[model samples]
Target chain A: METFQHSFPSRPLAWPADRSWALAGVVGSGNLEVLIEPNPAAPDAVAYDLQTSIPGYADSWKAALADFAAHYAVGGTRITLHDQGAAPVVITMRLRQALDLLTPAQP
Target chain B: MSRVPYHELKARERLAAIVDPGSFAEILPPPARVMSPYLPKLGIPVAFDDGLAIGRATIDGKPIYLAAQTGQFVGGSVGEVHSAKLVGLLKAAARDRLPCVLLIESGGVRLHEGSSGEIGIAEAIRAVFACRAAGAPVIAVIGSDIGAYGGMGILSACCDFRVMTEHGRLGISGPIVIEKWMGKAAYDSADRALVWKTSGGKTRYLLGDANALVNDDTAAVRAGIARLLGPASPVTLAAIEARQAELAARLEQFAAVTSPEAIWQARGVTDPAAATLDDAETFVASLAPAAP
Candidate 1:
């Protein structure tokens, strides 16, 4: 497995006072699971810890995550992913889904 | 009205859909990220829940502990953390005197983890008996196509009651293994009908293995679970002896039987073909109540 840690700058993620975490997707062939948890210790960036079965995709992962951070308010949280060769599109969707589930709905 | 097929639902989705709405309180959820420590070393991608999503939940307004296995994850094989969660949940049910439900969808032990998975299944089996002895019914739902196999089949058999569906199967050695061992002429795994008849819910329910057989829909499965939520059968010497004798009698009676059809016919399924085509509700209705 290729495991790595990275952080991207983004707007402060608004979290719910009642919830601790949110999760989306499952770790399977061509799929992955995204786990988002509060990271009060780091309030200005979204930290990522990723482990993928198919290695040599670090650049693509970083680019996708960086784009997600820029597009959404996901700072101040730690997202951990367990992937099994999911495509880039699927990964982006799972990250967004996890973040959406973690944060409360906006007006 | 048609409903979401329970077999198609994932582990967490099964828990959320079957139990009372918003009743699932996960013990060690994904965010906890209690992943497999061994998978990474083997260059295998790990699941945050270790392929078993276990937690507290309510069924029909009655509090119960529930666990759902993710069949997509290495065939929902039981590894260290996965089986440990099962043991912990069953133990908690025993301590609290609450019923425990297992929505099992596994092919057996995770072969990738080796003996760790095997030992874990053994521990989980012990915990199942512990809960049963405590008068806390350990109800298993063998309603997924993956069904219970290997150690899981043994564990499920230990449960106080089992709810199965037409899609579910329960057996130690699945068709492929039997076919490989006995040769194609003896047992053809490619024959889907023969395979299902051999191990599927209908035959098992007819043989008194599965306590309940319902439709594949989540709603039907939920109702099936609700029906078996009452008192558990006491684990006593007399019960064990009687069960053993019954099994022995069944084996002796069907020892020479060549097909599952004959077994079904012997069990009073007058038209095995017609009975096989019947839905879960209709099928059980046409037969005598399964042995206790």
Candidate 2:
């Protein structure tokens, strides 16, 4: 619900040999989706751009993104989120989930 | 309680009827008060609950995730938060590998929110496909007269199956819009019978678009959904090609036909008049493709 944006620095992702992009979440009420795609231009700085309807807590959004970037090695990717009113917890969780799905730490 | 028309029933009531008695455990219940953020901006009163009702329930004792749209609230349209909840529910169904049942009574995307709803629908469609890809069936039940229109119609078509009743109608543009486009002489919106005949459940069923047709009774609708809770029909390249051809043939066959009676006859109703007069049971039995 809060309007926010932040970019965190981490190691570049090990780009998948096959796919181009993957998206999760939907642009619906009280919820937002995250889309991750290969940004060949800047594979070292994972860009996080968020547009939210309920604006106010830009800091909370930044904190969530900072934590997600610090936790995951998603630097080589471009992360775009369309958020409605997701709690900070859900935002972080979805970010992690999308990262895991895209990179799949193990496989 | 049962005397009320299906369309008159609230979203929750519709869900209750289609699922097992006392089996529903609504996730994100109304107490959570997760409602639309855009309605109030447009001076529309927001429902205590979001336009959508979603949760886990059982159909004939088989567990599934159910989603119902509240037509009374904003034509059952999807808004930002509403659509997100829906997407989340479908994803949850995929994660749990459970069947997702949608009681569709929407007029498609909520125009108030503009592109947000449009994008939400596109995302939801992708989520629906994700479930289908994972072998979880997504069933759409269309019994309310509001039926499923606009983008929802195409989404319904993409579902694993659709169940409808005679009162239900499905299409992109509603009769009024069509009438406006073609003028009253070409399509009369006031002619309820003609409207029903064109987009009604019986016609859709006869065209093989509707997988099942039951009475307007909720119990019957529930039973129909129960029958198709497990199978997934992933659209493949070959299947898409076949559907394209079928649709082309349909357009070609109906090109010269202005009235629905002609459509029925073209589809091999020996006596179109009598066939239209027949009840669902007899009409279904009497159906035959026009002799090639």
Candidate 3:
């Protein structure tokens, strides 16, 4: 029922120098999934697009995405989030969690 | 103070109370804080484990993997994190050769998350069968009022056994939905007695869908759990065929009957009112073995 948009800055991801797209999640109630794909159009910025059912927390979402982009080196990827009323805290956590799973920090 | 009684215990508390004391070791604790990726735009409150509590525990010293749905949080619906936790837990049970006990209280897939919960439930079903194929037991407990509906109901049906209480209910679509679909003349949701007769524990027991019917009391539930802990029901092809044949016959027999009470009478349950009032023990003893 609500929609929001934001973009974050980050260094380009370090893949095997090959893969183009990586997606995670399906559309469901009370939850939304994210799909991160490689977008060469804007290598310096990771564009974020979000659509949700439970509206009125755009600022919180922006903060979460902004923080995630700043922390992760996921520049060339465009992250699209589809959510259905998940909490702001959960959104931030899941975005970070997904990124962590995709790109683990070196030991 | 806790607003609810035994039923009020969150998923974890329920698990702890039923399982052997101190035997529950949570797989991924809240400190891990695994949550749903969706919902913030909608402004929903997120639980620590995304509303599902999964862990390893023992009941009557029988090792089992326990997963309980938190109905309070989003109707205990499954989202990505919740579903993944469940899938992972089932996989763990399959790998460990442990029986899996699901304290089902979900309203099916979480609609807020969309198709992710739906697909996750399907995956969980496959996982359940995998465990069954591996000789691991998967027991579904429908003690909560939510019982299981939607995709979760089908998953519960696929389970080896279902244990329920008079307060418990099970069906693919809830009475409200059915009533809406059928209209008040066809099905009345507010008719509590009618609803119970249609899908309540006693009805399910008479129909043979519910393996055991216990009282609302926790002690009775615990006893029922202890009784069924020894064996996991595996759904082999032969068993499925047999069940299909049997269910087909029952449907044929009762499909034409508009009154649930009539079905009860034909099932050899004399005085439907008397039978409904009987406690779990009496109810089980009073009934004749299901007609072939």
Candidate number of the best TM-score: 1
State every prediction's TM-score relative to the real structure. 0.93, 0.70, 0.72
Kindly list the per-residue Cα lDDT of model 2 for residues B98-179, writing each as its tens digit: 9999989888998899999999998889899988888899998888888899878878888899988888899999888999
Per-residue alpha-carbon lDDT of candidate 1 for residues B211-269, written as tens digits (9 for 90 to 100): 89998899999999998888877899999999999999999999999999999888878
Model 3 lDDT at residue A19: 33
Residue B279 deviation, candidate 2, in Å? 3.5
Candidate 2: segments with Cα more than 4 A from true spot: A1-107, B1-5, B288-292
Q: Which 10-residue window of candidate 1 chain A scores lowest in summed lDDT?
A: A13-22
Clashing pairs in 1: A1-B43
lDDT of 1 by residue, A64-89 (tens): 98999999888789999889999999
Give me the candidate number with maximum DockQ: 1
**Residue pairs in collision within model 2:** A1-A85, A28-B80, A28-B81, A28-B84, A29-B80, A29-B81, A29-B82, A30-B81
TM-score of 2: 0.70
Candidates arranged by DockQ, highest first: 1, 3, 2
Q: How many residue pairs clash in each candidate?
A: 1, 8, 22
Q: Candidate 3 on B109-150: residue-level lDDT in tens?
A: 988888898899999999999888888888888877777888
TM-score of 1: 0.93
Interface RMSD of predicted model 3: 10.4
